[model samples]
Structure formats: structure tokens, C-alpha cells
Target: MFTGIIEAMGTLTELRRQGEDVVLTVEAPGLDFSDVKLGDSIATNGVCLTVIALGDKRYSADVSLETLARTGFAQAKVGDRMNLEKALTPSSRLGGHLVSGHVDGMGQVMSRRSSGRAIEYWIKAPADLSRYIAEKGSIAVDGISLTVNAVKGDAFLLTIVPHTAEETTIARWKPGHRVNLEVDQIARYLERLLQGGAGAQAPSSTLTLAKLAQSGFL
Candidate 1:
């Protein structure tokens, strides 16, 4: 798991295609891989990729075709900058929300405007993904966890402060730029639990104090 807090930015140094999959070598000069062993997981732009080879300032990983199809990496190229984060340790602070490093879908930046020292951006997510997003909820955009300031249709708004803009790749975002998006993990599981399965009936009415008292649960 991760915290969606970007530790550094890494550059895609090289990509080699092998059948339907590809091998990627990233130049992560800011990351110290001294203790990282083979098969360690790393979050590259919110996608959990296993480290196949560890070097002083570089590491290689294999990206599957499914991952490429679901993430913005389908159009990624060498020299592209990627947000990087190491797996969370037990002692690590939960600075950001829990991130699984699993991209739910791709989102496009619809608009951007300057709001004093902050920048407001509107991102349009996939139609199906819109249901999982909620106002004031947490969402990871391009691997940066941000709170949704508002939600309209299939799009959401975010306010990025100067510190966040400078620490990550959001500074390079534009109106048409595409980014990897990961919705809150809790929301997805809650939906599944509530939906249950066939023949299972969800609560017919909303849970309230009066209803709870009537049901003798309060």
C-alpha cells in the first residue's frame, strides 16, 4: 500500500517491447534503492510496479498489457516524468489517504484556472467511474492524492496549493492532459458490500436515529 504522497519524480529512461508486455527502466536519482531488493514494489504514477532490477540510480520493471490498457502509460514514452513513491512502512505517517497504487481509470483535464496562490483544475473521469466519486471525497490524480472540491456530471474540481504544485507533476498539467486516477479504496469496498449478491436485499430505507430506535438497534 501507499499514501499517495509523492516522494520524487523519476524519468523513464528506456522502454523495450517484448511481445504484449514491455520492460521499463526508470532513472530515480532522488530515491535511495540501497535496501530495495529484487521484486520490491514501487508506485510509478500510482501504478504498482514490481522492481525487477535495482541499481544505484535506476530500476527496471515489466509492465503488463492489461496495466498499459487501463492506465495513461499506453501513450507513455521515454523521458516522460512520473510521480514516484515507495511502499508505506508501518512507522510511516499517513500523510495522505490509503492508496493501493491501482489505477481505476484515466481522466482528462477539462479546465484550469488560477485562484490566488492556488490553482483550480477540473478533471473529467469516465462515466462509470463518476459513480464512485463524491464531493469532498479523496481521489488520486496522477498519483497525487487530492480532495474533490466539487463534483458535476462526470467531472470533479480540485484546488492545488503551491507546495503540491511544486512537489509533483501537476505543474505541467494542461487542459488536454491525461492522468491516471484512483478512487478511494473504502468507497469501492462499501459499494460491493451494499450491493451484496443475487437475491440479497439491501436496506430498503435510509438508516436514521428514529429507524434505528424502531428496529431496536439504537
Candidate 2:
């Protein structure tokens, strides 16, 4: 698990295709990898990747076909910047929301503008994933944890402060840019629990306030 807080930005030094999988090599000069061993998991742009090889200032992980199909990695290339984060330890603080580093779907940047000192971005999520998003909920965009400022049908707004833009790759986002999106994990699980409850005559997808009150979630 991860906290979706980006530790550093790494440069994609190499992408070598081997059969159906691609090996990604990143140069993380500022990230400490002295304690990282083989099989350790790292979050690269919100995708959990296992470390296959390590060097003094670099690491490599193999990307499976499923990951490439579901994430922005399908469009990634060498020299692109990647948001990097180490897996959370038991003692690590939960600075951001709990992130599984599993990209649920890809969202597109629909619009961008400045709102006083902050930058406001509107992103359109996939139709199937829109119901998981709520106003004031948390979402990980390209591995950066952000709060949803507002939500419309299949679209949401995010306000990025100067520090966030500087720390991650949000500054490079444009209207047509695609981003990896991981919706709040809790929301997805809740939906599953509601749909899979026993003794129900029929499975339901509707979420109601009365149901929340009965479930002690209100």
C-alpha cells in the first residue's frame, strides 16, 4: 500500500520490450534506494511495480500487458518523468489517502485555468468510474493525492497549489493529456459490499442515505 504522496520525480531512462512485457528503467538520483531489495514494490505514477533489478541510482521493473492496457503507460516513452513513491511502512505516516497503486482507469484533462494563486483543472473520468467520485472525496491523479473540489457527470475539478505542481508532473498537464486515475479505495469496496450482501432479493447498485444510516456509515 502507499499514501499517494510523491517522494520524487524520476526520469525514464530506458524501456526495453521483452516478448509481451516491457522493462522500465528509471534514474532516481534523489530517492534513496540503499535499503530497497529485489521484489520490493514501488509506485511509479500510481502503478505498483515490483523491483526486478537495482543499481546505485537506478531501478528496473517489468510492466505486464494488463498494466499497459489499463494505465497511461501505453503512451509513456523514454525520457518521460514519473512520479515515484516507496511503499508505506508500518511506522510511516498517512500523509495522503491510502493508495493501492492500482490504476482503475484513465482520465483526460478537459480544461485548465488559474484560480487566484492556485491552478484549477477539470478532468473527465470514465463513465463507469464516475459514480465512485464524490465531492470532497479523494482521488489519485498520476499518483498525486488530491481532493475533489467539485464533481459533475463524468467530470471533476481539482485545485493544485504551487507546491504540488512543482513537486509532481501536474505542471505539464494540458487539455488533452491523459492521466492515471485511482479512485478512493474505500468507495469501491463499499460498492462491492453493498452489491454482495446476502439475503437480498436482487443485487442493487443504488446507494441511499438510509442504507448508510443502517450500515452505521452516516
Candidate 3:
């Protein structure tokens, strides 16, 4: 697990394809590598990647085909900056919400505007994932934890402060740019519980205004 708090910014130094999988070399001199070891997990742009090889200030990991199909890494290139975070330890402070580093779906930047010292961005989430997003909810975009300022049909708003832009890759996002999105883990679990857990069949009808009224929930 991860706290979704970005510890350092890394650059994709090399990308080598090996059969169906690809190997990535990331260089993050700013990252503290003193305690990192082989087999450790690192959250790279919201995707949990196992460290296959370690070096002075770099590490390499193999990206499976499943990951490439689901993350922005499909379009990633050398020199691209990535948000990096080490897995949280038991003693680590919960600075951000619990992040599984599992990208649920990809989102696209819909619009961008300046909001005083902060930048306001609207990103369109995948249609199927919209139900998991709520106003004031927590979300991880490209591995950076952020609060949802507001929510529309299939899009959500975020207010990125200067520090966040400087610390991570949010500043580089533009309209139509794709980003890895991981919704709140709690929300996902709650949904499974609501569905009766595990392999239980889904409800025949979704909760709606009329159903809420009938159930005395309105």
C-alpha cells in the first residue's frame, strides 16, 4: 500500500521492450535510496511497480501487458517526468489517503484555468468509473493525492496549488492529456460490500431518486 504522497520526481531514462513486457529505467537522484531494496514496491504515477533491479540512483521494473493497457505509460516516453512514492511503512505518517497504486481507469484533462494562486483543472473520468467519484472525495491522479473540488456528469474538478504543481507533474498536464486515476479504495470496498460481497449477484436496479424515496433514504 501507499499514502499517495509523492516523495520525489523521477525521469524515465530508458524503456526497453522485451517480448510482451517492457522494462523501465527510472532515475530519481532526489529520492532517498538508502532503505530501498530489490523486491520493494514503488508507486510510479499511481501504478504499483516492483523493483526488479536497484542502482545508485535508479531502478528498473518490468511492466506487464496488463499495466500498459490500463495506464498512461502506454504513451510514456523517455524524459517524461513521473511522480514517485515509496510504499508506506507501519510507522509512516498517513499524509495522504490509502492508495493501492492500482489504476482503475484513465482520465483525460478536459479543461484548465487559473484560480488565483492555484490552478483549476477539470478531468473527465471514464464513464464506468464516474459512479465512484463524489464531490469532496479523495482521488489519486498520476499518484498524487487530491481532493475533488466538485463533480459534474463524468468529470471532476481539482484545485492544484503552486506547491503541488512544482512538486509533481501536474504542471505539464494539458487538455486531452491522459492521466492514471485511482479512486478511493474505501469507495471500491464499500461498493463490494453493498453488492453483498465476493461473488454475490448485483442488484437488479441501481439506486435512484425514486428508489431512494421508496426506501425512505430520501
Candidate 4:
């Protein structure tokens, strides 16, 4: 699990094609490699990849064909900058929402503008993914957790604060660039289980969970 709060940005030093999979060599000096072991999960641009080898600052991981097919990583090139975040620790603060580091789909930046002290961007996500988009809802784009400001058909607008823009790789993004997107997993699951589900009835059309609990049935 992850918080979607990117710790640092890393650069792909090299990419080597090995059969259907490819090995990625990335350099992230600030990324603590001591606790990382082979097979440990790390989010690279919202895609969960395992650590295949650990070095002083550079590490290598193999990207499976399935992962490549599902994410924009397939077109990743050498020297590409990626948002990086290690798996969450129990003691770590939940600065962002629960992120499985799983990319659901890709979104394209359509337009950009400068807000007061932020950057406002319009991203066009896939049509199927728009079902998960909602105003004030959480979404992970390019590994950075952000809140959706407004929702339009097949697209949404996001305003990234200056701090976030600077700390994450969003500052480096350009219009038409493809970004990995992961919608709020909980919302998606609930929407599915509540509507058109096998036996899920309406999602408790009554009051609230607290009210129900206070009334004795949890």
C-alpha cells in the first residue's frame, strides 16, 4: 500500500528489453534502499513495480508485459522523469489517501494554466474511467494524489498547488503527455457493489453508519 505522496522524482537511467518484459534502471539517491529488498513494491508513476536489484542509489526492476499494456510505461524512454514513492510504513503519516500503486488507466493533459499560486490542468481520462471521477474526490495522476476540482465528460480539471507542483513531477508535464491514473479504489468498489451487483441491494439508503451503530446494529 502507498499514500500516493511522492517522496522524490527519479530518472530512468536505462531501459533494456528482455523478451516480453523490460528491465528499468532508475536513479533515486534519496530513496532509502536499505529497507528495500528484491520483490519489494514501489510505485513508479503510479504503477507498482517490484525491486529486482538494489544499488547504492540506482535500482533495477522488470516491467511485465501486462503492466506495460495497462500503463503508459510501455512508451517510457530513457531519461524520463518519474514520480517515485516507496511502500507505506505503519508509522508513516497518511498524508494522502490509500493508494495501491496500481494504475487503472492513462489520462492525457489537454490544457494548462496558472492559478493564483497553483497550476490548473485539464486532463482527459478514458471514458470508462470517468465513472470514477467526481468533484472533490481523490485520484492519482502520475503517482501524485490530487483532488478533482470539476468533472466534465471524459475529462476533469485539477488544480495543483505550487508546493505539490514543485515537489512532484507534474511541473515537468506538458500538454498531450500521457499520465498514469488511479481512481479511488474504495469509491469504485462501493459503486460496483451497490449498483448492478450480484446481491448488494441499495447502499443503505437510510441515515448514516454512526446513526446505525448508535441504534445498536453496526
Q: In model 4, how large is the Cα lDDT of residue 54?
A: 84
- Please provide the root mean square deviation of candidate 2 (C-alpha atoms, Å): 2.9
Q: TM-scores of all models?
A: 0.90, 0.93, 0.91, 0.89
Error of 4 at 122 (Å): 0.3
> Cα lDDT for residue 7, model 1?
91
lDDT of 4 by residue, 160-210 (tens): 898898888898878999999999998777666445464756545545556
The collision pairs in model 4 are none
How close to the true structure is residue 195 of candidate 2, measured as C-alpha lDDT? 69
Off by over 4 Å in 1: 198-218
**RMSD to native, candidate 4:** 4.0
Give the per-residue lDDT digits (tens) of candidate 2, residues 58-113: 99999999999999998999999999999999999999999999999999999999
Cα-lDDT of candidate 2? 0.94
Task: Please write out the lDDT profile of model 1 over residues 92-155, one tens digit for every residue.
Answer: 9999999999999999999999999999999999998999899989999888889999999999
Q: Name the 10 consecutive residues with the lowest summed lDDT in model 4.
A: 200-209
lDDT for each residue of candidate 3 in 69-185, tens digit (9 for 90 to 100) = 999888999999999999999999999899999999999999999999999999999999999998999999999999999999999999999999999999999999999999998
Where's the lowest-lDDT run of ten residues in candidate 1? 190-199
Candidate 2 error regions (>4 Å) = 197-211, 214-218
lDDT of 1 at 11: 96
C-alpha lDDT values of all predictions: 0.90, 0.94, 0.93, 0.87
Query: How many clashes does the backbone of model 3 have?
Result: 0
